[model samples]
Target: MAFLAWSVCAHPHATGLLPETRLKFRPPPNSLFAVLLRSPWWVSLLIAAVLGLVAAALLPEAFRVVGALSGFPFIVIAAIAAQRQWRLPSAARVQQTQEAVSAMAWPAFQALLTDGLRRSGIEVQPAPAGDAVDFVMERQGLRTLVSARRWKSARLGVEPLRALQAARQADNTTADVPRAVCICLGGFSDTAADYARAHGITLWQASELALAMRGVTLPAPKPAR
Candidate 1:
């Protein structure tokens, strides 16, 4: 049965009759209507309306004839304009978005930490610093400093952690040694994680940072259901 089916399918006559046809449809020369409508949504709509009216006045059947004749030409024009105008702004938008996201590192870090700690029932107040100290947590009317470091790479060495410890030690007394939390975009190195754990500093990475932000606003007490 398999051999019979293969022989029938492989037959030259059967294959010749089932020829593939690629269809190509080209619009008419007078496609101004299509062209006018091919711009940004607002621009194309405005242009199409004006052009449609002008075309109707210049043609015999007013609306119907002019619209039918206008579709192809306008489509071509709009396609060209859309390709040029729409794509031109895309590169700029991408660049602007990149700049915006890059600027967000500090804010994202602050928000992430503030949200995370607050979720953990800790109230945090952000202190002004140059890309450092996202917030200082105030519990029981006493402030405990919490710093966030948003590193680009995951492999942050002990130097940063040591420096942070030193800074915290210098800034506050031994009694007020603020627990330093390093928030890294990428995952931390094994050594970094070990150092953080040994030093008693909370090291949050990736999605954990996002969760902390969401934790800040907890649900109010529900009525007895």
Candidate 2:
């Protein structure tokens, strides 16, 4: 149970450890994989058990063992789904976290973002001078640049994201293509979101930020000057 909770918390996005260079693959909406992934983890387990029992009872005695083995596939699927669905925060908690983040000053928000990334098992470091992004995050030998300095902006446009995308392309120090992420409190303009999708850049808007900071303690919001 503990490990499953950690798995969900560690990979807040569907891409898991992979960079957001492409859309994450998803099963069809009505498919078994989709149903299992969205349902409670125990539902898959229950199905497995019921299938084994029914198969065993319906089959001849000589083939009873073989019939019970039919549920093995579901058992495997159940374990995978459990790791993703367990210990997810309630909607209310997500809302509360977003509210807290919205009220934070840049310094406080930057600290919160760093702490949250660390908890997700990503090594965070200050971005090099003149980089458009504010931080560089590394995991599994791949680097991802993160820009959050304008997180408090009322509306993010394509210009800032375009700068990050250019920075990502220019960073040739590593073999792997560096990914980029842009964070904002009020969300991005339609054009900005489209630009990000085209360039494979990840955008951390209100909900994404809330999920990432789930269990981390948020700094107190600074008073206005």
Candidate 3:
């Protein structure tokens, strides 16, 4: 099965099929705090730890005891965060988390994305020429082009995503299908963000990947047009 899947993916030109029908969709309201919520949970605990340390250093004896008690849990949590950070893919090898996605063979890449989507409660289906745009995702009758790490430029611009949007339209299994691009390590140009927002393209960056993997509802971005 693995070999067969590879054979099919290795030659994208051979397999060309449209994704499912799409529905008009919107991401949930997002705030800085909401974005932070999806971030590594450790960040919050670390903030708490810093506050506790400040208390321990400055509070009087009677109050100091309260500070110490408040701080203990945060200290422990910080230690846990350190351990988890250690387990993440090496930044050296993984120039960007998206790099891993780009580096993997087609079968492996598709599998990883599919698993992540399943974990996030999104439905994934194999499509022809999946590698060209990585695969397709569907939820509530909505289809999206799901991809990661395909950009070569340092700052992502609007062209690439626009092309995908064009492809989606050309296929036209449905007109409302959206494009969801993962910007795991790089930043986007203001124009890129504006283009994505105007086109209703969904983007996932940094800790937001955690939210995406969990299929967390996204907040609509409204970059100045």
Candidate 4:
């Protein structure tokens, strides 16, 4: 009789039963645990009932109500697990997006450097070597080699300045042509700036570059007569 009663009460087609009683045999959402449990409503109910039975069993006869209370907790845990599984993939995708942005750091800096120089009305030349140099700028009919480096810990040491001087001197320009500049994204060393000043070379830091490019637009050159 108990077996027949259980089968009828748990049956999906059982008549006159409460909606929740009918749901007790339905399937859970597609989660790992649900898959393991075959997503069957009976499995979840069975688990909950078993937990309640255990809790009730562990209590004194007078407090046996505790075991019967486990069903709600079991359902809550399953619901939480399902939600977590659904959100895990979204979290992973966000992490991947962050990594991609990090990988593009160098490319972003290069573009910023090139664009800033070009937009400042400077005629920039292609670099002979790596993508380090921002661009080659010209002003007042003088050919000036230009480079931009954006870094927090960067310092303008003597070596780069020496190389720039050497390259300019070796170029075909007349002796009176001024040397080029290395624009640092940050400030420069006091000694480095002083040395550049003494040698008639320009040292443009971030602030100076900002000021120089501010409100300045270059017009197209007219054709020579």
From the highest TM-score down, the ranking of the candidates is: 2, 3, 4, 1
Indicate whether candidate 2 or candidate 3 has the larger TM-score. Answer: 2
Mind giving the per-residue lDDT tens digits that candidate 3 earns over 29-116?
Answer: 3943334334575775777767777887899867976775665544443544454454343443343445444445556645665676
Q: Each model's C-alpha lDDT?
A: 0.48, 0.74, 0.51, 0.49
List, residue by residue over 27-97, the lDDT tens digit for candidate 1: 34356433343436456545556777777776667465646445444334454455435422244343433
The weakest ten consecutive residues by lDDT in model 4 span 12-21
N/CA/C clash count, model 2: 0
Order the candidates by lDDT, highest first — what do you get? 2, 3, 4, 1
Among all windows of 10 consecutive residues in model 1, the one with the lowest summed lDDT is: 10-19
Note each model's CA RMSD in angstroms.
Answer: 23.2, 6.0, 15.3, 26.7
Clashing pairs in 4: 26-41, 52-67, 55-67, 56-67
Q: Which stretches of candidate 3 lie over 4 Å from their true place?
A: 1-109, 127-132, 149-153, 182-184, 214-225
lDDT of 2 by residue, 1-225 (tens): 222222212333532232121214545789886777678778878888998899877988998888887776667667767665554556766677777877877888888877877777878888866748898888877788888898878899999998898888888869877888898878899999999999889888776776667679765545679
Model 4 lDDT per residue over 29-110, tens place: 5853446333434555567778788877788876667557646645644554443343222443433333332233555645
Off by over 4 Å in 4: 1-106, 129-134, 150-152, 173-178, 212-225
Best by TM-score: 2
Q: Candidate 2 at 35: error in angstroms?
A: 4.3
Error of 1 at 140 (Å): 2.8
lDDT of 4 at 157: 69
For residue 193, model 3's alpha carbon misses the true position, in angstroms, by 1.7
